[model samples]
Target: MPKTLLDVDGLTVRFEVKRGSGWGKKSYLYAVDDISFEVKQGETLSIVGESGSGKTTAALAVARLVPAHSGTVMLDDGNVLEKQGEDLRQTRQKVQFIFQDPYSSLNPRKRADSIVREPLDNLSEKSEDEKTTIVAELFEAVGLRPEQMKLFPHQFSGGQRQRIGIARALATQPELIICDEPVSALDVAVQAQILNLLRKLQREYNLTYLFISHDLGVVQHMSDAIAVMYMGKIVEHADRISLFTSPRHPYTQALLSAVPTVDRTQRAKQKRILIPGDPPDPINLPKGCRFANRCPIAEAQCSQTEPELKDVGQGHKVACHLV
Candidate 1:
């Protein structure tokens, strides 16, 4: 069996939002709600969902960027949520993040080389010469010229900025890299370049990824396994081929339908499954099925009771009463 690099169990993160006026009560936002999943040693396990879904929030919780309200984020043998101070700092070295927005994530004030070397300067006890060598090697690995290192973030193109971010994330040689919609902000052509770079790095370094994205097309290209999130809950989980070919949950089916396909036969027969109704307010979520309001096949039972994510043969799991 493959060694599990990261194992998250019942991980929940809640945020307090004060609604409007002074008289109003503070309601909680369930950004990540009791979700559990794992990423194997060198594999990418993608968390794909809609805009409001808790995929990014869950990744943030795992990295301890945001506080996890309850549950465990097990990175190998250690539970990240339990770590404090120096231990937390050390845990952070093992896991790094590549943010979505290339333009904003990179430091505008710092030079490209400075931004990439920041992680090493903070996390490692290496000498200045060692850091320089590491940074130069990273620049070469990410397809950037050594001369470009002195330039500021703005000096680089959008795709080049993202490559710099990728180089920074790899500075500490992290075992698990959380890529939060890394290519979503780049152009279509640049998106492919970034995606290809990520795959090459993963192979070269044997890195594990918790890739979060709304684009199923990108997910299909990169993921070994996929988890479908809806309203902060994982409604479906399966291998990429299984999930794409046979989505059991209504929410997952609707999401996959929205991905544009090139197969002419499929395009001719496949009708876009439009989901009805907006997602339920996070503060006041449905007691039963969260997607019940928008599910085309939802029955009365779906509104009355929540369904467990049960295995329906093979390793495929779906959380729907009808499934």
Candidate 2:
């Protein structure tokens, strides 16, 4: 097995929410509540949930792009959350982010070559000529023509813009990449191309990915391990096959049941597990089980106390009172 590349424990990220224009008490929104997970070297671990479920928040906090309220992010070399000064700068070179929106993420004023060269500029002391050579190589690496390097962001198609973003993320030769729904903004055909490209890049570079997405099909295709999030918490985490075939968490089961299938027999065999009620407000989460209100099997005890993530063996973990 590969060694651990990232180990996060009890990570909590909070934001102050103001309800009124003035003189109102400030309430905290727990964007990412105390959650823990790890990524193995060269493996892809995906965080999947509905919108506002904190997958993106967790990833951002891990990348140190956002300040985390609490917890430790342990990398193989050091704690990512605690680094400062030059140390932090050096640590950031080993981790990169691929943003969700290709349109907004790239600076329209900058050419594709310049955009990809930005990360290398920040991380290294390479001269302009060397940087240009490296950028040309990266452009070709991401399947973009080197001739298109001088083109601005607006000159490229949506998929090509995303390729530029990918090239930028790869410029620093990062070991770990935090991809926050990187392909969601592209066309369906383009999404497939990007996915295949990511897979190919991972194998070629031995990269570890912390991929976040709402699409289960995409998660299934890309992830080796999966974490199911609800109300800013990880309710279930398991190896890919186990989570897909035998998910234990109520939320996870409900999520898988909703995935559309074409086979009539398979569809008949799979019982739909619809969740009841909308998710709780993040600003004022429930005191006990966050999913208690919507869980079909939740009992009186479920709402009275929070459940710890318990190992159910076979590399599966679940957080549920019933389980």
Candidate 3:
């Protein structure tokens, strides 16, 4: 079995929101409310959810880009949250991020080569010649031409820019790459190319990815395991095949039902599961299950007590009263 590369436990991130007048009653918006999951070496674990589901916040917390209120993130057996100064800087090299918007992420002032080599320059003690050679190789690896390295970010199309972003993330030879909607900004045709490129690079470099996206179709294509989050908590987590074939949580079922399918048999077998009512206020969440109000088959007990995520069989875990 492949070793676990990243392990997150009790990760919680909160934002302070003041409602009333000056220094009024302060409330905490629990963005990521005590979620935990692990990604194995050389595999993708996707966290999928709708807008305001806190998937991005969770990813940001894992990378230490945002302050985690409380949690332990173990990356390659090292406690990421405990690292400081140079220690944290070194940790950054092992865990790089491919951001959502290629247009905004890249620097307009710098050339492609400099952008890609930035990580090597900052993180590693490589010679100038070595860095240059690495940048050239990275351009080739990510399917960019050698001559194009001199061009600015505005020179390339969206997809090409994303490839450059991927190259930058790979510059340090990272163990884990957090892809924050890596292909969402590209065209439909281009999205497939980038995703395939990422998968190819993963196989070539033995990279592990923590992919975050709201698109189930993209998640289905890229994920080895899937975790469904709603209102800052993971409602369900399972292997890709099991989650898609037999979703245990109501939220996961509703999510899968919305995915467009080409297969007629599969399409016919799926019924549209519409969740009614907006999610409860993050600052003042209900005491019971966060999804109880919206769940189709939620019982009286669902609103009285929160369900703990537990494995039914074959590593499939779900937090639901009626599962």
Candidate 4:
């Protein structure tokens, strides 16, 4: 069996909201609700969902950036959420985060070199010369020239700025990298370059990635395993090929159908499955399955009881009454 690099069980995150002035109702916003999943060593597990589906929140909770209201995020043997102060800081070095906006993630005032080297300076006891050497090596690894390290973030294009972010994430030699919509902001051509770089790095370094994205196209290219999220729960989880070719849940089917097909003949035969109704309010979620309101095949039973993620066949799991 492949060793699990990360394991998340019963993970839930709830945000409190103010109801009115003076006093507020502590309504829970279940950003991530009772989610359980695992990433094996050196594998890319892409979490896909519509906006506000809790993909980003799940990633943040895994990295221990946001407080997990309940459940455990076990990184190798350690529970990341339980650690604190120095222990948490040390554990964080093993799990780096690559934010979505390269333009905002990078320091506009600091040189690119400084931004990349910042991790090394904070985590490692490396000397000034050692930090410089490491930063230069990282630049080369990410396909950036060493001389360009002195330039500010604005000096590079959007894709290049992302590469710099990648370099910084690599600075600490983390075992797992949580990428939150890493390529959504880039052009189609630029997205490919960054994706290729990430794949190459993962192969060379045996790095595990938890990629969060709403774009099914990019998820198909980068993910070994895909987990589809609806509302705050995982609607389906399966291998890339399985999920793409044989989506069981209505939400997953609808999401995959929306991805534009290149073959005109296939596109002609494909019937687009449009999801109706806006997403339910997180603060006041409907009873039973969250996707019940939007699900095309929703039955009366779906509104009465929530479905649990159950195995169907060949490691495929789905949460739907019909499935």
Cα lDDT tens digits for candidate 4, 63-156: 8888999999898799998998999889979999999999899989999999999999888777999888889999999999988989999999
In model 3, the clashing pairs are none
lDDT per residue as tens, model 1, 1-323: 78988999999999998888867777889988888888899999999998989999999999999999999988879999999989988988999999999999988999999999999999888999999999999999999999999999988899999999999999999999999999999999999999999999999999999999999899999999999999889999999999988889988888888878898988887789999779998988987999999989989998899998889989898999998
| Highest lDDT scorer | 3
Clashes of each: 0, 0, 0, 0
> What tens-digit string does per-residue lDDT give for candidate 3 at 13-35?
99988787857677889999999
Q: Which stretches of candidate 1 lie over 4 Å from their true place?
A: 20-25
Q: Write the number of the candidate with greater lDDT, choosing between 1 and 3.
A: 3
lDDT of each: 0.93, 0.93, 0.94, 0.92
Segments in model 4 whose C-alpha atoms lie over 4 Å from true places: 22-24
Clashing pairs in 4: none
TM-score of each model, in listed order = 0.97, 0.97, 0.98, 0.97
Q: What is the TM-score of candidate 4? A: 0.97
lDDT for 126 in candidate 1 is 91
lDDT of 1: 0.93
